[model samples]
Target: MRSISEIGEHHLIRRIRERAGDPPSWVTIGIGDDAAVVEPARGELDVITTDCQIEDVHFSRAWMSMREIGAKALAVNISDLAAMAAAPRAATLSLALPPALLVDDFDAMIDGFLDLSRLAKVPLVGGNISRSPGPIVIDVTLIGSARRRRILTRSGGAAGHLLFVTGSLGAAAARIERFEDTNTQGSYERSEGSYERPVFLLNLAREVAANRLASACMDLSDGLADGVSQMATASGTGAVVLSSKVPVDPTATLEHALRGGEDYELLFAVPPRRRRGFEKIAGRSTTVTCVGEMTKAPDLLLDEGPLGGGFAHF
Candidate 1:
């Protein structure tokens, strides 16, 4: 058996892909991308998703506050829904907390979830809590609804469709790198804030669904390259992402933009003719850029180069 480190990231991904099998019909999109999309029924589309955050695995209690953890747990799942071009309506949370956690601490965490829920206009419908002998674990599941024929699926992208991404990438990844560097100071802490408070692009999802402007859509949760590759694979197409056209934080490196996770931004495919309309709808606050174009082949190329990878979980 090959060790994960020895196999490297791409090889591990290939191995996983071989075992995962084809996506289901309702799953217009599946495991390869930033988020999966499932069509619940005809005329009405419901997006279903879940994400888990474990202490030390996904975050560190030493660096992250209870509030941040709570908010992130919810935001990330909703971000998945947004990727499907759906509007989140309800959520359920399951928490495993250490015995040492005080009741007040738990309350603060709930408060954080509630705060973001209110902002997103999604409510917490139900949940479960329990004591854990191990590290803290948070699992969140969200359900979002979309109008008939409006939900975007990764499989919809085709050759000639233009690829676009919303907001800057790599800020969160850069922040995490800074936090790991002992030589860093207060600035590093500030950078980490981006990771803690990710903006969920619900409004963008609504616009895409309403206008049917996007040929395909998914959020940038795992990193731009990985997300785009997923779309290509599902749609039975290929893509060429120009590195220069990708929007990255001024302070972040190109590598970070390509592989960073937790950015919670949207990556979509649109018809060339609709490019201007999407740009106008995205507006000034959110940076939208045409990073690539879909191709007939199944390969995912970056700047006409080999595949640019993104974050992965084994």
Candidate 2:
């Protein structure tokens, strides 16, 4: 199989552009230009988010396929936009390919990338790809838009606010633990299969924002405790998460549920009286569980205990 070097930058970019297919109607100019040109709707606030996946640190090639990595990179960043209740617009990718990588792998990555963009109705406007002597790196920048009042943030929470999280937790952590223990990726249908990609709570977030159901919101990227702590501190309040109320994946531990990051589910706060309204809005389309409550004190207590350190690079 040929390497990326064999195809050259121009040809490689051309192939990727072709794979992305035509740009959406809202995009004026896409790949092959100096920068992507997007036409956002009037009065829509632009929401931008970036996330990266690096070899050894964020992932290992031996544990997952190239396409899965690509999907994961895109999904994580998009989930950030969802936390803000933003509508996805376009995305840009910056990839550093190791010399040992095959051209086919790069192509597969683009396939995964395009698949996500299509599903989310977002366009891949532009990106830069380079050769690197070090590990493979993928940095994704996702752009989204939302109305002024629709933008959600962590600072809006206050004492007495009810805390809720979308979907289950700890599965992603369990998957990583199992992978580290066995050095095996395992099947996608398994309990930990959800770890492979993030579930962007876009619709649920929109409903929360549109109805003003949530006072604060964020995706659980750095784990439940860290994310909840961040919201509490940002809002000038404290939080207490009930251990029993936390929805844990059957295969994962409570410790994993507390500190395990990258679940990509939304952790949000609603006013005391708005719980029923928020639940009504979310309906049966998604699972929203009340896990905690905001407190007057300024500390993060996980069931009356201290919060653990979440994922950190340093």
Candidate 3:
């Protein structure tokens, strides 16, 4: 395979731009321009979020393919937008790469990133690329939209709001554990299914936001325990998370479900009066469960003990 140094940066950029296909009509200017120019949402608020995926810190090259890494870099940013019931509009990717990287591998990474972007209908707008002295780095910035007054915020919960989480947790965390265990012995296996492509909760979150079903909301990228505590702290209320109500993955332990981050599910709060309305929207495909409730006091308790920290990057 030809190395990145052989193809040169400008050529790689041109190839990526061509491979990105066409942008939506809303995107007035896409990849070739100095910066992306897009039409504003007619009746909604623009939501923007950025996330980074660094080699080793986020994923080891020994454990995952370049393509999977690229897909994951975008997915995490999309998850942030989905947490607030936002519809993805456009995305920009900045990559820091070593010149020794293979051109085919770079193409594979772009393919993976664009595939998910196409699936989400978020066109790649514009971004920068630079050479890295060490590991590869991928940074994604996603722009999304949500209707005014209908966006979900972490601080919207009240004392009587019922807490709910979408989908089961701990699968990703369990997979990470496996990666760590095997990597210690100088070998690693890619987990079945795209652990890199996490479930996007935009549809469910949009429905809940549109219907005013939830009072507070956030994505569980950092485990259920941290999610609950965050929402409670942001909303200035206490929280009570029932251990029995948490939907743990079949292959994962309860500890993994609670503290193993990267679940990428939605955690939201709905008032007791609107519980039925929320339930009507949640159906079977969504798998939402009432795991807790917001309280008047400021204490955050999971079952009977204090809710601890999770996945801190200190």
lDDT digits (tens) for residues 102-203 of candidate 2: 988889878877777788888889999888889989999999899998899999999999999887888788878888888775333323433333434787
Better of 1 and 2 by TM-score: 2
Comparison by TM-score, 1 against 3, better one = 3
TM-score, every prediction = 0.81, 0.95, 0.94
Q: What digit string (tens of lDDT, one per residue) describes model 3 on residues 1-314?
A: 79998988799999898899888888899897789899988888899999999998887777777777788898898889878889988899999999999998899889979888888888999998899999999999999898888889999999989999887889888888977877654334445544423434777788888889899899888898899899999999999999888899998987898888776788899999999989888653667889989999889998888988777776
User: Which residue runs of candidate 1 sit more than 4 Å off their true CA positions?
Assistant: 1-43, 183-200
- In model 3, the worst 10-residue window by lDDT is 191-200
User: 200-238 in candidate 1: lDDT tens per residue?
Assistant: 377776786688788888888789989889999888998
lDDT against the true structure, per candidate, is 0.74, 0.84, 0.85
Q: Which rank order by TM-score, best down to worst?
A: 2, 3, 1
Taking all chains together, the TM-score of candidate 1 against the true structure is 0.81
- Alpha-carbon runs more than 4 Å astray in model 2: 185-200
lDDT score at residue 114, model 2, on the 0-100 scale: 78
